[model samples]
Every structure is written in C-alpha cells, then in structure tokens.
Target: MNRPLCIAHLYPDLLNLYADKGNILTLKRRLEWRGLEAQVTLVTSSEEARPGDYDLVLLGGGSDREQEIVSRTLRRSRDEWKAAVEDGLPLLAVCGGYQLLGEYYQLPDGTKVPGLELLDMVTVAGSPRLIGNVAIESDECGTIVGFENHGGRTTHHHAPLGKVISGHGNNGTDGHEGVRYKNVFGTYIHGPLLPKNPALADFILQTALDYAGIDVKLEPLDDELEKAARTAFQVRRMNLSEVAAQTP
Candidate 1:
C-alpha cells in the first residue's frame, strides 16, 4: 500500500482504559520502523466512516456503562462494520470490544445489551471482578502476555474463542480470554502487549500485510533493545502473577 496506513480506533470514548492508546503508538512506531507510514483516526458514535478508509480497526476495553454508550452507535453502524470484517479487514478488540462482538452482554438487572454477534460467544456478567495479569503459550503463535480486568465472563457458545496459556481469562471459566477469528484478534490483554511481545506484534502486522498482499522483510531490532524489552515484559508478568497469587 503506497498510502500511509490508517487505523480506525473505534469507541475511543469508552474503550481506552489502561491507556491502551499506548498500544496504538507502539503499532505506529513498529510499522514506521518497517517503512510503512501509519495514521490513527478516531471514530466515535457521532463519527462513522467507510470501511475502506482504514487498513485496521481497533476497539479498546472500557467500562460497562461506557460499553453501553458506545453500543448505541455500534448498533447503528453494525452492518457496515460487519461487512468490513467479512471483507477481511484487520481488527483488534480488547475486553469491552470483545464482549461487544458477542451475541449479547448480560447486565446486572436481568437486562441485556445486544452485541454485534460477530463472533460465536456470549459475555455474562459476574461478581467479584476478574482482574490481574495473564500468561499464554500459543503453539500456532507463541507466548502471549497481558492483563485481564473485567466483571463479565464470556462463554464460548460454539468453538472456544481462543486457548488460554496463562492468567484468569473470561472469569476463570477457562474461556476467559477474548476471541480471535481471521485477521481479527480480540483479547483482554492491556496496552504494552505489542512492545513486550514483538513476535505477536509482528504477527499482527504480517496479517495486515498478508491481507494487502504485501511481502516485506521482518527487520530484527538490536539485541540490546530486544533484551531490555523482554526483560521489562517478564518483570511485569511476574509481578502480576505474584499479585494474583496473593489476591486470595
């Protein structure tokens, strides 16, 4: 793609907890390092753009109330958004985003907020919020790291959204993690997953490249910088694990 890559950041109003916006910065920098210019565009309920305008779409984690707020707009533009995904557009949705993609999110008062149902899953509200860091090992992918913080538990009505390598996902129900289908990878992992796990980051970038039919070399970062990055990642993982172990 000759033009600078555009990323559609959906529901920034409610889906940016944990400063997940940092992930976008990490992605942008990584892409620029690989010689692909990147641009991030925000899309709220009031602002809707054509699917073809972006190379990637992102939905971050947010509060239940915020999720409901964003849902209003999502419900209105869901068809166009779904069409974009059907066309193989790249998407990365976090906790709130992940829940919104399911059939529906069961609220506390027996009320239900309808979801896009883009994936075969349902998020049911739970008590004693699930929070903490997680560790995951993907045979097809690799080691994955991130934190999970949510009160809703997701159940895979059909196939499991994804496998769990580490951490308490989907409310410790074994399906605690988010769903990943096609070029879309939805998870509860917070910001810094990209900076910590460069391999996964490259995987995402490669997915976009593959979709665009672009072949590019995966330039390796300097050994010193790579080690420092991994060390920081490990430290975070260990700390979270320790905290979770002591939570009870």
Candidate 2:
C-alpha cells in the first residue's frame, strides 16, 4: 500500500487569483485515479508553514497588494521555509508566488517587495504585461503549455526551468521561462498549469513522493483528453505566430 500524499497549499484564500485551486484539484484527482490517497492542508496567513509535515508545497498567484500581505506574513517564518527548501521539500510557486520566492521584486513605482531569497532571482515590474498562451521545452520535464500574464520580468542567475518555445518567458529577452532550484520549481505560466501538462504534474508528484521515501511508481493514466488539449493549444499558438509574422 502506498503512503498517503500530503500537500500544503499556502495562502489559498489570498493567493488564488488565477483559478489556482485547479492545481490542487488536479493533483488530488490524479492521485485518486491512481488509487493513492492525497491529503491537502490549506495554510493561510495566520498559520505557519511546516514543510516537514507535508510532502509537497504549492503557492499560487495573487494581486500585488495580496503579494505584499503574503510577503509580510511569510517573513515571520522565513527560516522555516528556507530550511524546508534546503531539505529538498518539493515546491511549486507560480507568478506572484514565483516573485516572492526570489530575491526581490521591484514595482514600477520604485517600491520593492522583498522576497524570501530562496531563489537567486529578481523580478522588476515594467510595462506591457506578457499575456498570452505560452509553450516551453523544460529541461526537467518536457514540452509544457500554459498562459502567462505578468508585468514583472524575472531574471535568474540559476538554472532555468525551461526555454521558451512560443511565448515571452521571464524577461522576454532571455528566452527562459522559469527557475528550478533543488526540488522547487517557479514559473509564470498558469492556465492552472497542470491539467494540460500531465507530465509536469507527475514529475512534481513523483519528486515529492521520492523525497518522502515513498518508492511507489505512479502508474500511467488515460491522458487522451489532456494530450488533445495540449495539441489544440499548440496549434493555436502556431497560428497566432504565423498571423503575426504575416502582419508586416
């Protein structure tokens, strides 16, 4: 019998701006389908993040104001989180959460949002938000698809999560999409991210399981619909690119 997978969802009420709850649902359902049990604990602003109690940690996007609030809340327990990540806790942080995991994020008005310094990166907010369907070739996973919408351009000094294939990733000039540090992954893409990329989801799950000393292999599921959705998005992205090319 496989041990139950425990997931810690950080700030669900404050940081779920982009249907990020879908990520939790996707992870839980996938585990259930494979006959494995999943337990998700919502860690709010009032609660401390105990990484050792969970197999995986999830942080989602939020508004700038919410990000500030969350940042302040996290500061109280920064050492706990830092130690957790260093101990190989699997983490997935998207958009605002991604920025918060970095060194800092500078707002357009020159205000600075201090990060946990967990990842060696910085995000600077600028004009013309990168909003569109995105595709990338991840070094750890494979082809990944999602949507990106952010004015903050992230520049990382560490290994990137993936190279941009059909979207403006990171700063739009670096051709990188996200950052990967140890078992933690950060990205700007969030069509809830996981439903269309089962491979990436499984990678995260397996990594978390492995860290927990659970050696059970995840059996494959019927991903026909998931593949079709990914293909459709790829086709649409290609068409859009072609149209832009012919615009001149």
Candidate 3:
C-alpha cells in the first residue's frame, strides 16, 4: 500500500488569522481529486513536530501578538525547519510567517522581532498598511491573485514569486510580490491564498512530489469554478486600474 503524502501545518491555531486552513483544504482535495492521498497534521508545538515526518509544510499568517507566540515554538524547532529546507522539503509561508522566516521584522517603535534566517530578508514596520486585492504575473504560475493586508515592508535577496500586477507587494515602492528561494515560498497575499490559484497550488504539490521522489504524475483538474472566481477578480482588477490611472 502506498503511504499518503504527509503535510505539516505549523502553528495552525495561532497562525490562521486569514483562514489559511483553506490552503490546507485546497491541497488535500487536489490530491484526493487525482486519486492520491494527502494527510495534513497540525503542529502547534515544537515537540510534536518531527522534521522528517512531512513531505511539505505550511506556515500561515497571524497578528503581531499571535506571531510572537508562534515564534517561541519556531525557535525551539528552528533546526528542524532549516534542515528540512536544506533537504528540499517544500514550504509555503504567508505574511507573518514569511516575515519570521527572514532576518527580522522591525516594529514601528524600532523594536526588532527576531527571525529564523531561513530567508535572506528584512522587514520594517511602515505606516498606511498595504491592504487590497493583489494580482501578480509569474512565469511559473501565470497571473496569481490574492489579498494583502500588512504594515511591514519587506526587502529580500532572491527571485520573487512574481511581479506585482495589481496591488502593493512586499513594499509599496517595489513591484515585487513574494520570495521564492529553492522550494520555500514566502508571500504576503492571504485571503487563504491557494483557493483560486490552482496553478500555484499544483506547483507546490509538484515540488513536494519531486522532493519526496514520488514519480506519480498529477492529472489535470477541471477548474471551471476556480476560473469563474478568477474572472470576477480580473474585472475588479481592471476597474481598480482605471481608478488608479485617473488618480493624481
């Protein structure tokens, strides 16, 4: 019997400010729809999260205080995460999770929130939070869309996931949206991320499959509903673009 692909959702309780569990659900069902099995394990504490137990990992967004709580567990399990990434374990980290994976996330008052150094990046708190719908053009995944609501401006050294097509990305000034280093993906777009972006979801799945050396080919899924969702957003994006063009 084939074993199911295991996924670890770290600090799910504390890091689910944007209902990111939908990202988990998206992965799980995408597998099942292809006649494959996927098992998601919620890992809230360091002790329960064994490094070698998962094929992939997900770290969702959270508020500053919530992230502070998760950071303790991450510190305790930092070695495991670092090792896993080195060994090519696929990881998707969003917003606060993304910030924590970097060098530091500095607060407005100049307090430095320590990071795991998993990604070579830094974030500084900024005024006028970037909050809106986002669309980015990615060579790997076409036009990816999501929502962003953050006060931290992040600067990183790596190939970004995509160029900003619609809203404020890592920083409002830079036209980049997210970071892609090896198999780890860090993004600020939440709105539960993976639901409408099937291409990005499958890219993550494919990377996990490759990491695990699983040779099974993932069959294409019918995504009419997902297409409908994207169509609606595309119209809204156009309207926003028109509005921006008319602005001073």
Candidate 4:
C-alpha cells in the first residue's frame, strides 16, 4: 500500500499577512481530486520542521517583521533546508520566503538585512513597489499568472531566475522575475497561484513526483475544470497587463 504524500508547510511567524495558505489548500485539493491522499504539516516557530521527512515543503509570504521572525528560525534550520535542497527535496517559497532565501534584503532606509544565503540572490527592498496582478513567461514552462504586492526586487547573480511573460515583476521594472534554483521554486506572486492556475500546480506536483521517483501515469483533468483554470489564469493575465500599461 502506498502512503499518502506528506507535504510540510513552514508557518514561519505570520500566515495571515499574505494569506498564502491558499496555495497549500490548492495543492491538497488537487491531489485529492487525483485520488492521491495528501497530508499537510504546519511547522511553526516553536515546532521542528525536518525537510527529510516530507516529500514537499512550502513557505508563504510575510512582512518585514514577520520575515525577521521566519529568518531567525530559518537561520537555525538553514543546515536542514540546505541539505534538503542538496538532496533534491521539492520546495515552493513565495514572497518573504523568497526574500529570506536570498543573499540579503536592503530596506528602504538603506539598512541591509542579511538573508539565509540559501539561494544566490539579493533583494533590493527600497524600490518600486509592485502591487496587483503579474504575468510571467517561464523559460521552462509557459505563461504563469499571479498577484504581486511587495516592497522589494530580487536580483540573481551568476544565474538568472525564471523569465517574466507579462506584468511588472520584481519591483515592476526588472524582466528578471522569480527564482529557480535546482528543484526549489521561489516566486513573488502571492495570489496563491495554484487555485487559479492548475497547470502551474501540475508542474510543481509533477516535480515532486519526479523527485520521489514515483512513475505513475499522469492523470488528465476534466475539460471543464481545465477550461475554468485556464480562463481564470487568462483573465488575471489580461487584467494585469491593462493595469500595468495604465499605471504609468
């Protein structure tokens, strides 16, 4: 008998700010729809989150204050996360989680907050704030739609993250958007992308499957559900492009 896939979510310190739990629920439901039992574990600041025990790990967005809280906890767990990544454990980190994985984050006052150094990226915090919908053109995949409300822009050194297909990404200026290091996927979009974009969810889940060495047949979703998800993603993409063009 195959056990259910275990997914662990790092609660950090704040889970309500960006309301990123939607991503987790989206994945869980999607898996359930595919007849796969999914189990979720939330590891808070007080709890121990060992990445090796889980098949998938997710981290949500948070504020600077909350980032501090999560970063502090991550600093202690850095070794575990680094090891997990090195060992090819799947990870999905968004916004503040993305920032904390970078080399550093520069505040508006020119104060530089050190990051976890997990990914070779730097975030310039005091920059053009991008709030609203975002469209990204993936190098590995296709159009991805989500919302971005952030005060920082992340830049990758030596290696570039994923590409931007539409909307202003990473400070609403840079074409360099999102970070993809190894099997770790970090993005700034926070509309809890999975619910509205099932392809992206499939992409992530497939990655997890590959990592776990599970060679089951990839199930195809129903036409109605697929159409709905694609339509939702398109609406978001078009709406964001309109907003971006009108903003300036």
Please report the candidate that would top lDDT against the real structure: 2
Better of 1 and 4 by TM-score: 4
Error in Å for residue 62 of model 4: 0.7
Q: Which tens-of-lDDT digit does each residue in 121-187 have in candidate 4?
A: 8888664577766777776657677778888877776343456666567656568678777888888
lDDT by residue for model 1 over 10-128, one digit each (tens)? 86766788676877887888888778877789886678656778778778888888888877777776788788788898888888887888889999887788888777878888898
lDDT of 2: 0.91
Return the top candidate by TM-score.
2
Candidate 3 stretches greater than 4 Å from native = 45-47
Report the lDDT tens digits of candidate 3 across residue range 1-248.
55688898988878898888999999999999988899889987444577688899998998888877777667777888788888888999999999998988898889888888888899999999999999999989999998999999999989999999889999999899999988999999889899989999999999998887778778889999999999998998899889999999
Model 3 misses residue 42 by how many Å?
0.8
Model 3, position 53: C-alpha lDDT score: 86
Candidate ordering by lDDT (highest first): 2, 3, 4, 1
After TM-score superposition, the amount by which residue 213's alpha carbon in candidate 2 deviates from its true location, in angstroms, is 1.3
lDDT of 2 by residue, 1-248 (tens): 66789999999989998888999999999988988899899999888777779999999999999999999989777988899999999999999999999888999999999999898889999889999999999877899999999999999898888999988999899899988999999999997999999999999999988998887789889999999999999899899989999997
Which residue pairs in candidate 3 collide? none
TM-score of each: 0.87, 0.97, 0.96, 0.88
Q: For residue 207, what is the lDDT in candidate 3?
A: 94
How many pairs of residues collide in model 1? 3
How accurate locally, in lDDT, is each candidate? 0.74, 0.91, 0.89, 0.77
Which of candidates 1 and 4 reaches a greater lDDT? 4
